[model samples]
Target chain A: MLRKLFKFHGGVKPQTNKTESTTQPIAQVPLPDRLVIPLHQAVGGHPRPLVAPGDKVFKGQRIGGADGSLSSAVHASTSGIVHDVVPALMPHTSGLTTLSVIIEPDGEDRWGELDKVNYRRTPPDELRDFLRDAGVVGLGGAVFPSYAKLKPGKEGRLKTLVINGAECEPFITCDDLLMRERAADMLKGIVAMRHMLQAEEVLIGIEDNKPEAVAAVQAAIAASGQSGIEAVAIPTRYPAGGAKQLIRVLTGIEVPHGRRSTDFGVQCFNVGTAYSIYEALELGRPLISRVVTVAGNVDRPRNYEVLIGTPMDHVVRQSGARPDSDRYIMGGPMMGVRLPAFGVPVVKATNCILVGSPALFPPPPPEMPCIRCGECAKACPADLAPFEMYWFSRSKNFGKAQEYHLFDCIECGCCSFVCPSHIPLVDYFRFSKSEIWARERDKEASDAARDRFEFKNFRQEREKQEKAEKLAAKAAATREKVAAEGQAGTTSAAAETPDVAAKPAAPSAEDTKRALIAAAMEKARQQKAQVAPKNTEQLSTETQADIAAIEARRAAAATPPTPDA
Target chain B: MLTALLVMTAVALVLGALLGYASLKFKVEGDPLVEKIDAILPQTQCGQCGFPGCRPYATAIASGEADINQCPPGGEEGIRKLADLLGREFKSLSEEHGVEKPKSVAVIDENTCIGCTLCIQACPVDAIVGAAKQLHTVVAGECTGCELCVAPCPVDCIAMEPIVDTLDTWKWRYPVIQIKQAA
Candidate 1:
């Protein structure tokens, strides 16, 4: 057991409402009539749907293939027929819908062909590809593609693989129960990842609060004969589950800004992610179902092996939520999003579903002016000046807020939890970030429009200048020819012959060439301005050689016959 | 007398040398973490907490310049985190800083809005953009709902509305627990 040395910024010990639902083993929720499986379950781009409409899919069958390097494939959670590939309800706070494979379950949970690949002999890159194909992602709050994090940096110095057991978020014990029950499987997952990453050390950092979990993990590690794996118990604190915080606590390294821990020769994976990795590698199972903790003011607080995209209302109903339930939150209370309605599906990021009455976490205290007591500054865990952020956020100074590192605030609710004024500090920061992002998007759009306009204007101006120059040169050439004809004692009628014969054709051709040049220049301006141009039509190219030749011949020939000046 | 004077001078110089060496060796390098900690502060120029701005407040928090409870904008979460970061005892957000409210962004009712650009001038973040005497519109996404614009609006077209949580805008809210399920 190791004690935490570097004190983090701010946190609060909220009422540990964890025991209410964890007494019973994980229960399997009854299958819903329709399963709306999202194509983009894990972070990154949406997977390409493999099974079209009306295609029959078995339980654990791949229905969507990975579309990008940073995406995961989508699988059928149960044996069902594809009802429709439509924009279905997703478990998101934004309330925006995403494409989902709506399947009407046949009630028979029959699995598809299991590809039992011998992962031991398989290359690490191949194993990673297999996992990605199987649609595995971090079961932690972040549903980032797991395989993406597996690859080492450019140096390929993979040293330690830390299994995060820090269920620091109050009311989340899904990982704990999983460790207690399926620790050996979790170990297998760890070993699989270790082999793939070629990590020398595997450390499972569990909170000391869960002694049972620690013991279970330790026993599992021992039974697996894994000398490389060590279960290290650390002090339980809020945000301990944070990857950066856990990495700091375990190895004493801060994940530098905008870089993954893998960059610094350390790879951190959630215990749940490790377990999923095991299932994918050994059991040939895709990430179809996961253990979700259903707790809070519900009648039954228990963990359930729920299908992905199972609506919160279904889970709440199964848990016997109170009749007058005012709020249903997905994930731990400290940072869980409140569902506007219970219809939001269970996403990969969901760890817990909290159904609570007003009495449990009372509505925050009535708005009060800040007392200038310097309390919020004392409570922030990210070392942020919550008070200052609040002022800037309130004053609508998003730039100032960002300069204060508004993006760094994890929205842990610790500041709001401890505010004497009962101020919802996280809300303000969230608002500020949203505003800043909005402004950035607006500025980008406007900048693009302005660039286009400026480019168009420049092309037009250049075309006008070039056209004027050409017309002047043509007129000058005609006058010089006329003068030369008169000086050479030829008839004025002879000089007029060429001008009369070629005038219409020449002007028309010149006009067309000028127009083309103008168009090309406009397009070139666009191409130059764009970050990435998909086609060449946007580029405006001018024929410089022809114009240069014309000018050069005219300058040298004086009044003698010049070729098409 | 010469010997005594030499001995006294030698002792004085030796003592001075020792003191200077001690000062150089043990000149406490103030906490290296203060600047980073300060960088996280909300740089709201509004001195509602009595500090000139966010950095001063951060310095006060880090170097014990001011109490962590002073900022109203930071609220409870800010105070607790600061305490954790600075290794200070966690106190509630100062009552004087102001109560936390549902985040609202400014919205301009285009129909009701006159060409007055007072709200534009009042916005600290430059969230509002419109020419003087031109029809003004509130960029809902950019408006932080600080309410500074609300006060400055001559026609009272600007209203602070709670940011509608849409699917894209919705982030996973941290879950509150009643029991710790042992993993």
Candidate 2:
């Protein structure tokens, strides 16, 4: 059957250096003295370390448990004693370190207990959990947990399953070699995934440049006698291997921004991921090793099936990298980041270790001002306005950059690869994205603070009002009690003497005033009597007569003076 | 002329009555201006703005009783917001209130805590949780870092710790310019 293919917008075809690596078969590297596996190999929450320091662990035993539903577990690559669980350098553009479990290999390489379950008999959800425990994730540079992609969407079942074998990036041929050597195992994994997703059709899309891979996958499909699986050759284009691009090519579906491809009844997985799933289910193996392509400036470039935590320096030394190779990149030239140091451990996302020299990757030319050339826009795979976004980002105008759909850029480096000005366009986009995320976090914190403050104010006001209300209530009660006591006193007085109550209702104002005046006059008279000559009785008789004579004279003088006035 | 004067007088009377009825029918009830002002003030409720709380400060601002710069917790950015909202001139936060500091949360030294409920009673936000004569701890999530609880602690066990930046909160710094060696 002829499968219809669709074209996506804006792609660049760089010189393909994939032939050097594919010239040799995938080789297996011996276990190093130690392994330093990072707990966060997939694109989700970091897994929690299960093996503590000084604990002996067996090969295939879980070293880290899945942190959440979206995370994948990590397993011991070889039988060893855990030396330490500490933060170690990881292969990231930011040159940051993550929590890693370092194990000193015991040189035994013994296998642990294996429990192989029939995936067909197992429920779909349980199968997904099994794959998660197996630490299966997308091996196509994304490292997204594979079980997440296996679950069906609201439509209840996936209509189409896409197997991306399009090893489209230059100097990265891990997937190509994977398809050539392990096509049957990949097909088995695909069958298992199809069973889990209940997908109707499986489309394996490989770029036409990798004719051998396409042929091998075709032969595998024929040998398996799978009616629904079809191996189709897509055109060779940079980033044609991007999940969305390959999905569009095979299914003729454009996955809109912010919506998953499963929404269109289509789901995509890497061929390497499919192989890992097969190994995990059929052999009861946990993912501890992957095929890594070592190329660029090395005397002999090839793909090696390297353990997950092998140091990059060890891999480079094994690859016979030239003395003049000054830098190392972890992906294709178009989208790879320079290694901070060569000793960082290999992560699940490390597909290609491109050794850099002055000859192969010359330092980028001095950046010139943008000449308003539309080449970047023409080469943008997502069809974004790179120059406009660059302008806004350069000026730190994040809002305007967001208006131009800055986050839609996948940072595929297509625009940067084709720019005449030699501007690092993707770097700008990354900066804008990180800035936006930081601003969002700040806004969230501020919002939380504001909420707490507002609640505090509200509570304080309520408590104050409550205190005032209680005081008012207490005052009102006291007044009521006092009035009741006064009423009781009046009632008791009336009950004791009815005649007293009838005496002009206790006394009128004039009568009370007259009585008060009469009492005051009588008290005054008594006071004058006491002050008069009461002590004179005890005095001598002559003294008393003299006192009387003085009083009589004073009285006569007073009477005459009053008459004259 | 007399008929014209009578007609104009009747028209004026009818319009006046209609206007009076409309005023009664469409009178706005609440003080929306105060709410608008309150929305702009950082609701710290620290009482540094001389008012008892944010709402009261907002009310004072809306009524032109308080200056827009009096809220130190609101800081300069908050004052700008209020200025923009009220169409007033922007001014620096008043130094009399307090100096603006980084967001912090209160932590209690449990060992030294005297179990005196003074800190709990001092906390304006009720963020402290404990009973009388019991070790009180601040609910860190709810603490506004107002620093009101620190002074009233008899043992001086409460400390205001500034929130630290972690990997999740780390912002991307500007990329340093790489100078290429002349080859």
Candidate 3:
């Protein structure tokens, strides 16, 4: 059946330098000397490393345990001895390190026992947990754990399952190659996901640019005898592979900004993710390796099935990267981040390492002022006023940027690609978005601190009130006993006034407690001298002088007592 | 003329009673400006501002008894916000209170701790936990980097350490671009 597709608001078509990488089939890269797999490959909680240094681990053995329900577990890519679990550089623009398990391969790729589950008989929740522990995540560069998104829709099942084969990014053909070669396995996984989600229909949206992948998926669906699944070809556009954009095109449902597609009875997954699910459930294998494309500034561009944590330079060397190749980008040229160095590993989010040279990807021209050209707004795929948002962002007016729905920009680079003045509009939007998030986090922390401080005050006040009540009760009993002895009203009232009722006179208990505490503290201080920390005790002479000065100030502060202060 | 004077007196009496009743019915307690100022404070309870807690400092500021630059934990950004909020001129944070520093949390050297609950009692947010004569530890999440526990520890086991930025906590920096503006 011919499928009519919907168009998203605005998109730019960059040069699709994809044919060079798709010439050869996906090849397996030989094992490197060491692998450095980061524990945080997905979007949620960082997984806790389970394997320590000097531990023997097998291929498919879990190396990192899921930190929480939202997190995905990590597996050993191959049988090896763990060298260490330490912080190593990650493939991020910040060049920050994360806790990773470094392994030295023993040349034996031994697999651990795998538990295959029959999806038809298994519960959906159990299947999701299995997927989490198996490290099945979106392979279209997002790397969001698939288990979290597998949650049942509001109506108990999804209305449509949109499989994104729209690999619209230039020079990234890992998804296309996978669809062309392993379409049958992908269909099996997609069918299994359908069973788990209880979906009514599935639409495989591949860009018309990859006709082979589209035809292959259509043939696979026909061969598998799947009734509800259909392969639909879509117009080739940059960022059409974005989950929201693909969903909008396939089902004509524009998921509201910042909301989940599942909320609207639709769920989307990358085609490679479906293949991994099929391998995990049917073959009893865990996610350890994926097909990554090594393209740009290389003599021979090709796709390789590389183990997670394999260094990027190792793959680049195989692809014959020229000596002039200066940098590597981890994804499409439009949306990928520039890798700080080559030693960073191929991670779950890595789909392509577009090696860059001054010749291949020239530096952008110096920026000129925006002339109210409206070109950026015309190319924004998310339908945002990019120039206005950029203006507000550059001025550090994050509130105004947010008012323009800055979060929906998706950092797609369409605006920058189309800007005649060579403005990096998306970078401004990213800055504003990060600033907003940072402010929100700061506000949350301050709010929490305020709550804790108020609670502490309330507790102290209540304790004081309770102490006064107890003392008053004791004094009342004494008054009654004296009255019984016929020494009534006036004397007892005077005694009570001097003791229980007056705030100043009631500190007898406080005085005794303080005395006891002071004695105990003196003893602790003496004992503390023996174990005093070197850092705090042997302070530099400057710090010592500062401390002495502070001490004198503190002594002066004691002269005139201020309430609570 | 006598009847007109009686009618005017009665009207005045009724209006006076209504005004008195309205005052009694809707009497507001506590200064709301103090609450707004308190909300702007960092809630560190560090006493670096010469007040016991954020609320007292806020009260002082609201009553014109304290300057707006007394809080160091809130830093210059916070001062700017306060200035904008109160229509006051922005002032550099007063060094008398303390110099602004990066956010940090207290870490207790468990080996050196002598089980005196001084730090616990000194904690304004009660973020420190331990029984007297037992080891005391700070609940790092709730410690608020107030530094109040560091000074009062009889054993001097507490030290303030700045939080490290990891890949997860790392953020995209402001983009650097040189623009040639002719307008």
lDDT of each structure? 0.75, 0.84, 0.88
lDDT of 1 by residue, A353-430 (tens): 888788877876465766766777777777878988888887877789889888888787788878897667788888
Worst 10 residues of 1 chain B by lDDT: B174-183
Misplaced by over 4 Å in model 1 are A1-6, A462-565, B1-183
* Clashing pairs in model 3, backbone N/Cα/C closer than 3 A: none
CA displacement after TM-score superposition, residue A326 of candidate 1 (Å): 2.3
Task: List the candidates ranked by TM-score, beginning with the highest.
Answer: 3, 2, 1
Tens digit of per-residue lDDT, candidate 1, span B1-183: 999999999999999999999999998866766666554444332234554345556666777767888766555766776777878898876655544667667788788888787666455445677887777876654554445566546676777688655544454332222123312
Q: Taking the tens digit of each residue's C-alpha lDDT, what string does model 2 give over A1-565? A: 6778999899999999888888899998878888989998898878999989999989889999998768999998889999999998888756777889999999998889977879999988888899899999989889999998898878688999999999888999999999999999999999999988889999999999999999999999999999999999999998899888999888889897899888899999999999999999999998988999999999889999988898888888888989999889999998887888888888888899999999999977866678879999999889899999999988888999999999899989999899998887888888888999986755564456556656754665576556556655665565567667874445444343434333443343334323433443344346457967678778899988999899988888778566455
Cα deviation in Å at residue A449, candidate 2?
Answer: 1.9
Encode model 3's per-residue lDDT on B1-183: one tens digit a residue.
999999999999999999999999999997789889888898887766767778888999888899999898999988998898789999999975667889999999999999999888777788999998999999887888877666567777899899888654567777767654322
Which candidate has the top score in TM-score? 3
Taking all chains together, each candidate's TM-score versus the true structure is 0.65, 0.77, 0.88
TM-score of chain B in each prediction? 0.67, 0.85, 0.81
**Per-residue C-alpha lDDT of model 3 across residues A188-222, encoded as one tens digit per residue:** 99999998888999999999999999999999999
Instruction: Indicate which candidate wins on DockQ.
Output: 3
Q: Considering only the true interface residues, what is the Cα RMSD of candidate 1 after superposition?
A: 19.6
Docking class of 3: acceptable
Q: Give the Å shift of residue A327 in candidate 1.
A: 2.5
